[model samples]
Target: MLRGVCTALAAVSATGALMACRSPHEPAPLTVRVDAGSVRGIAKGEARQFLGIPYAQPPTGALRWTLPREPRPWSGVKDVGKPGKDCAQGSPGPKNPSSEDCLYVNVTAPREHHGSLPVMVWLHGGGFTQGSGKDYDAVRLATEGKAVVVTVNYRLGMFGYLGLPGLAGSGDFGFADQIAALRWARRNASAFGGDPRNVTVFGQSAGAMSTCALLTSPAARGLFDKAVISSGSCGLRWPAGGLFPGAPADRPYVPVAQGQDDGLAAAEELDCTGAGALACLRGKTTAELLPHSPSFADHLAYGTRLLPRDPAVALRAGAFAHVPVLIGGTRDEARSFVAGAIQYDPELITARTYPRLLKEAFGRHAGRVAARYPLSRFPSAGLAWATVLTDASWACSTLAGARDLAARTTVYSYEFADEDAPNVNGLHVPDVPQGAAHATDLPYLFDLGGRDLLVNRERKGLARTMVGYWSAFARTGDPNHRGAPRWRPGTAPLSLAPGAIRTVDAAAEHDCGFWATTAR
Candidate 1:
């Protein structure tokens, strides 16, 4: 078997750990003992899936707004065949129920036991507001990639990210949970036939944003060796009305003081003010605090012990962890956002309102911006506005951040350019053809919502190619091997599509030079 011979030699690490090969006479075990307890997972096709093992204690009551602690040990074998409830969310849908006791990690590995296989840890994307590690099925990533893949569930919204004044772990409870997951991975990976030393942390959307925070956070040092950031670089910024019609100009993170102020506001609204506000807030039921959750959506704070400054600033000053990075976003990244805005108010942005929208976003540079991205080039006003945001806010910011990372460390930037990419977003507009928008690249790598989004053979082939690229990257820092085209890091991204994968001149294509002058 491949695990017995080929992987035996490949499993050798710098520290000279024991070989990851299974002895020919030894049988694979159905149950494994981890730090917490013995867990028995199911055999999922060609992979072993251990689902919903707690890495941290539940952050309920006195634990709210505090750093994560190691899980209390158990005495008996735990059945981890199914996922736990996702962290308590602001919006718990019929399909996606959640709870506060949701700090679980799911592990998927090739069925054949290989002790030294590379590790890929996935952090899910839901705007730091909602999402669970269970939402992504990583069996393919584990079996095909020949790696151990772990998807994590961290606290979400106010439950995970409250920055009360004088609080100890202000604005970093969520990030702390991620670090704790890494700690668990490091401690238990070898038992799962994974190389803890060769872990690569990757995520999309707000998960990607958290990965950005992970790179810049002092407390997260040595947790992982490589990073894959998708769609949510620290440098990504939305101008006023760029995200949606009335959305404010913002980045994912805020100042600590700002977060504290929002926290206090929540306290006053809930009538939990004064010296014991933290305790009072903690004592409130989850239902009582759900409404104020959205306010902390993009409010991960800086100037705290976890993150000293903005990750964008940290990258510019070369203060981030010196790890190889794979970063980029989809081509038409903002069509989904604009499409949603138009869905709410069909007349919110027509030909008549497009110019006014530009003025509100770009201010003095509105005319120049209009001239550069004219309505004649696009199908509808919403599509045109989406293009403006795709270029100015999404593409350019990602490219610039990639450039910064390449200057400091190795970077392989890519743009998932399949125009007919699957719409994993689940938001549809008759006018907006979701062509490679935002998280459309996700399904190419992960089976999102526990279902494969790729339907056709060509897209499935592209998914295979992407898995090859990603798994190879997980195996080694560089994502290059035979049978795939060469991927080089530079200012622009390597375009990822079904048949025509190649390099692209993104600055010229996106009018980044014009936005460079106009951007605030």
Candidate 2:
């Protein structure tokens, strides 16, 4: 119904051109013909944006939990003026919309580009439970970096990663959707003036974890030429008394048998049993299914034909895509989590409960952890706890993964160290001085909802530098460019702070030696 109205307006405007008359000063209409059909996009400044382009058929009803298939070719021009609905998940914000039919990708390209430009495909992060590709506006990256950018939407939660026994390839539907999007990009990038062979896949947090998974996934071997993993790594194993106790810190991969067991338990709880279980499950409404679905943050089943082994294990064996990788995390990644805990329970910041908390988290290594991260050293017990976990779970583990990746291919590591980086909206918790915490670097590249907060000259410069480095990496495998400082690989990670960008020994700075010893 909505599309019909748009099509009627297009037909009235002109015979073939699906756009209203505009002033001569205005930019021309943006349209690109792809495999499925021709899509009409919007022109903003010097960039052409095609939003909400479906790469696969809707994964709803009988198609639920199944691998994504190519979207049926449409006869008329598709109106890609706005973003499509995000995959079904808990509401990320009051304004965010989601649905089951959410396998879409958005493309942004420079309007004045000559030949094919490098393409950067982005994946959003929300712990695999929330977030949509539309949250990021890539106009800045497209115009300033002189590259074509693609943001993607894949299924989340039960719709994306339900691991039932009867349903083959159930848990990996999201990964498959991503691969399908890449295949679409490979086939249609030329329409948008993008080089399919020079595609770079980049993401942050859970998105970065997905990128790491793609590196090891047999199905994604040749889909991307390079990768940028931010604030996440694939080699981390949940430590005994670490940030997420009992959870795997690496790219969480569950065995097929374990996944099937969990799926059966979930089905039993939902009262969907016997031969009609899948039918019953699929028939349930979104409201009924949301409360019963397992936590989306849990690991997906690996060791299948799609993903043959754990990502970390596969990386160690050099059984992954040998693409150049840029990997790193923020300096105080755990501060935000610790600040939230302290806000909920003030006793978490008290010295009296510090050792007890350490014991609860560290198990047998409490004493050693306490000695290394004493309460006297930090401003508060919360800061100390945050520091310890930052080293153990994030910094050291990520560096370890970088080293392994470096052994096989070129690797560039970095640490965002701007202690007073502006906190993004929804993350500005009171009393929490988010010191370049997890995902703080997002604003430096994409113009998110809180782009105005980074208005200062220094922050703007950093954003420009980051965009340059990222775009340069997309153009070539290396991130080096003129005007920016020389970014050496694997020797010392480049420290990115306001007004300063240079190399620093992140391993020594984060006390990786102690973490490495304890991790082993």
What TM-score against the true fold does each predicted structure earn?
Answer: 0.95, 0.91
By lDDT, the best candidate is: 1
| Local accuracy of candidate 2 as per-residue lDDT tens digits, 290-394 | 654445454566877777788878888888899999999899888776676666666655678778767766678889989999888987776777788788778
Give model 2's TM-score versus the native structure.
0.91
Each candidate's number of clashing pairs is: 1, 2
> Candidate 2: which stretches are off by over 4 Å?
1-29, 91-96, 240-251, 425-432
Model 1 residue 264 lDDT? 93
- Name every residue pair that clashes in candidate 2: 241-361, 241-362
Best by TM-score: 1
Q: Over the stretch 1-520, how does candidate 1's per-residue lDDT look in tens digits?
A: 7555545654543111333445523434557778778898898788888999999988887887789999999988999999999888866567657888899999988777655788888999888888899888998888778898999998888987888889998888888899899899988887678887898999998999999888998988998999999999989899999777887898899998998998999899999999989888888888788888887887788999888889999988888998999999899999988988888889988999999999999898899989989999888888889999999998998988888888889899998899998877777797888989988888888888778988999999888888988988888888886788889866568899989989999888898888889855
